[model samples]
Target: MASTSSFDIVSDFDRQEMVNTVDQALREIKSRYDLKDTKSTLELQENAILVNTDSEFALEAIHTILRTKAAKRNLSQKIFDYGKVESASGSRLRQEITLKQGISQDLAKKISKLVRDEFKKVQASIQGDVVRVSSKSKDDLQNVMQRLKQEDFPLALQFTNYR
Candidate 1:
């Protein structure tokens, strides 16, 4: 009989990476020639980022910087939800970029399906937002993990609950 163990596959968003990327982007914006003299500001908050610029062109530049940073950090570009631009002091426009954490419901289902499809010999079940895989043999479980890494899911997935 094959011995069985269970593990959960979850994506733990890397908050530190996001913060680091934001810091780097801020530095670049500060030193950039055109933005150096503008009355622009970038601020990070718990739920979103606030970017204020003197003109639309500067706002576009800031958006580009943010997108680049998000990509560099392996974050999905889909997470950025642009809020309405509000008029700030001195005719400046302030834009808020909302950051979303946690895998979406659809993504969770997709991941669960992927795990099951890839490891045909193993059984996979979706528990809330995580995928739990069970196999009788340790080798089979290891093989599944290897295959998952090869597939390269968007989120940073982790495995747990091995029994």
Candidate 2:
């Protein structure tokens, strides 16, 4: 029997890069004029980043800062894994942003479904928070990759584990 060539498709968001970007954004916030007074805050949990601000404007400014920093470092906005912004307290709002590397099980399932539906040639299965794609022919796998790239998925995708 011929061994099938297989690969895992996922978003390419380096966790370390994101951490570094967040650190730089924090530093910039402290130094920037408009942001300095707002006292915006950022915290990285296991799977997500928590942002807190005094007002909506401050929250947006912080978001912009994070986005710019990530973009400058070649990180995609799709990796942001954005969550809904909600009121935390009086004049305070909070946003929890998920990381592509630490994707939620629900999102992972969604991705796997998308890949299976979008790529008819390859077989895809959700393994924990990651999706595995396998195909007998490398050409089929390559075609799947190309199709994935053409579509706009909500989350950042990184391809890995090709064999």
Clashes of each: 1, 5
Clashing residue pairs, backbone N/CA/C < 3 A, model 1: 3-136
Task: Give the alpha carbon lDDT tens digit for every residue of 32-94 in model 2.
Answer: 888888778999887789998888888888889999999998898876767999888767888
Instruction: Tell me how far the alpha carbon of residue 27 in candidate 2 is from the true structure, in angstroms, after superposition.
Output: 0.9
RMSD for each model, in Å, please? 3.7, 3.2
Give the lDDT of residue 45 in candidate 2. Answer: 82
Weakest ten-residue segment in model 2 by summed lDDT:
99-108
Task: List lDDT for all candidates, in order.
Answer: 0.80, 0.81
Cα-based lDDT at residue 72, candidate 1: 85
Give the runs in model 2 whose Cα sits over 4 Å from its true position: 81-91, 100-121
User: Against the true structure, what is each candidate's TM-score?
Assistant: 0.68, 0.77
lDDT of 1: 0.80
